[model samples]
Target: SSRYGEDLGKQDALGNLIRELARTDGIEWVRVMYTYPTHISDSFLDAIAAEPKAVNYLDMPLQHASQNVLKLMKRGGNRKSLERLIERVRERVPGIAVRTTFITGFPGETEEDFQELMSFIKNVEFDRVGVFTYSDEEGTPAYELPNKVPHRTAARRRTALMKEQSRISKRRNRKRIGEVVRVLFEGESKESELLWQGRMETQAPDIDGCVLINDVPEELLPAEGDFVNVEITEAHEYDLIGRIVLV
Candidate 1:
């Protein structure tokens, strides 16, 4: 579940609601997205670690990693703090997939700042990442900032960041091969009707990668929303190929 613009972990009421939903027997997976870095509390991490139904994944958007750029954006955390938080999260929840987003070419962002962000990505090695170019939104604090980055430069930076992430994603996905994972069947694969599409616990619906199920027995085929175990056989840049493992 995503709480856009608001940090769910900071709000006790919403966090409790999510915890309750995660503990529900019928809910196969509970994913959290768009959590602010500074506001992620210990209670939130504890609940995620303890809940069996809570998917071990998080989407935390850290706009930029460079201290100068982060300060300009008023994002309330430095590179060191973010690194520490990520480490803590991983330590608290083993095998958790951490997804994050970054912005490129923000106002006053120097070449060194961009490189610093790239270095941060390499160091963090996030399980999933997305990078976007800064847009000049009128009436926003950023719009009035000096030294706005050129559109061309911003676009180029976005491409570079995504390229780096593609490599990271492929390497990460490849490690999943040979593992048996529970997949939540979504529907038929978009590429072919003969194949089915599903997502593992690490993969959030729509935003993350999927498992393409092949060679399923007619009688054992799973319905939509059914959780079935699949043995991963192949891994692509963003998706995995697997066949249903009939018990």
Candidate 2:
């Protein structure tokens, strides 16, 4: 579920293989992660949108929106291209949850650049966002740079970005309330006597949050391959509290 690299060329073959597997008789869900912005083709996006078994979620790592930092990192795409790519994906697949990561505190990073990245995040309104303080690796150009930001400053930047994202996350999750969402049962809850744990369409295993199934009827509790319809009763910062709608 973790995609460490930024090259889509390395992932396209595997993506095709996964698509073929989705064509198999019983496969019902296929989720993809770690998409590179520059390498994602129109065909791939179309296929992803059209495939029923493929969940419309992509975890693309853009690192930073600042052109200078991106150039130093040797990343392929620019801000304009990133904007276009995002717009394309959303236009192709309505309601797709776009998840992303942004790196902070790169060498020579200006306050204006960080602010620009913040503005970009706000505009994109990503479903899930993660920010990492830049780690200087030996033999990397960034490591050899003279204008290294203080560790505290980097941490502060990371915190600030995530704080903004937290509000966005809460607002997005709130939109699901009162809507019927299909949930895949993961297990029974230990904390609450009548609560069972499950995940809705937007949630991935362990990374994103989950839905709590409370006060379920005897014949309507969740099981594997059984997608239970549940109405979102409450929305948390990262998860949902819901009761089975039994549709």
Candidate 3:
């Protein structure tokens, strides 16, 4: 919540919890969400990248890149600072999957601001991204602002942003083909047990796609909280198919 955002010191608690959970027996995956850009630090990135059990992924939502819109939303950071944080993550972690969220149609969001956001997205080349049209909550200052973007306009902008992200995601996923990725075996797919499900380091537990193994060894098929190596052979829309390399 915004309350925690007030103090950057509280940010370490979430990352610490992830480390604690990953050390647990039944905890095979530790995914972090709703991270704000301002709270990120050098230590947090180091811990996430070095942790063996934790998935090497971080989701920091920087709603808009424009300075005016950021101030209006009280996001607590500017565009330059956001870019530096993204660059820092890439520099510190070799294969880190940086996911982020965005918002469109905030009151007074201009065409220039939207273009700036698009440029930022293109430059970052994030592994995963999500976009949403602005929702005017009861207590938010945005709700009471004039020049509220129309629903259709907001939707069109959101679509444009998503289209950009979709292409980038497809390219990133395709690059993983033939790589031996460590997957946390979750369970059987709805289609059949022959089709087992799992996820690579870049993927979170539920939000991201899964690794679909067509056939599995009787002993290697995991119940849960299990880690195995899978060689990515194919990519689906949001999922992948892999052959077991280690169990």
- How does each model score on TM-score? 0.92, 0.89, 0.86
Give the per-residue lDDT digits (tens) of candidate 2, residues 72-166: 77887667778888999899878889888988898888898888888888888899888999888998777888788887888899999999999
lDDT of 1 by residue, 1-247 (tens): 4343255444555457668998787787777878878767776777788888888988888998888999999877778888999999999889999998899889999999998888889888999888888999999999999999998998998898888888888998899899989999988998799889998888887788889988687678678989898999999888999998876
Q: How close is candidate 2 to the true structure, as a TM-score?
A: 0.89
Report the Cα RMSD per candidate: 2.6, 3.2, 3.0
Could you say which candidate leads in lDDT? 1
The predicted structure with the larger lDDT, 2 or 3, is: 2
Whichever of 1 and 2 has more TM-score, that candidate is 1
Query: Candidate 2: misplaced stretches above 4 Å?
Result: 1-18, 189-194
Rank order (by lDDT, best first): 1, 2, 3
The alpha-carbon lDDT assigned to residue 30 of candidate 1 equals 75
lDDT of 2 at 37: 82
Model 2, position 241, has a per-residue lDDT of: 90
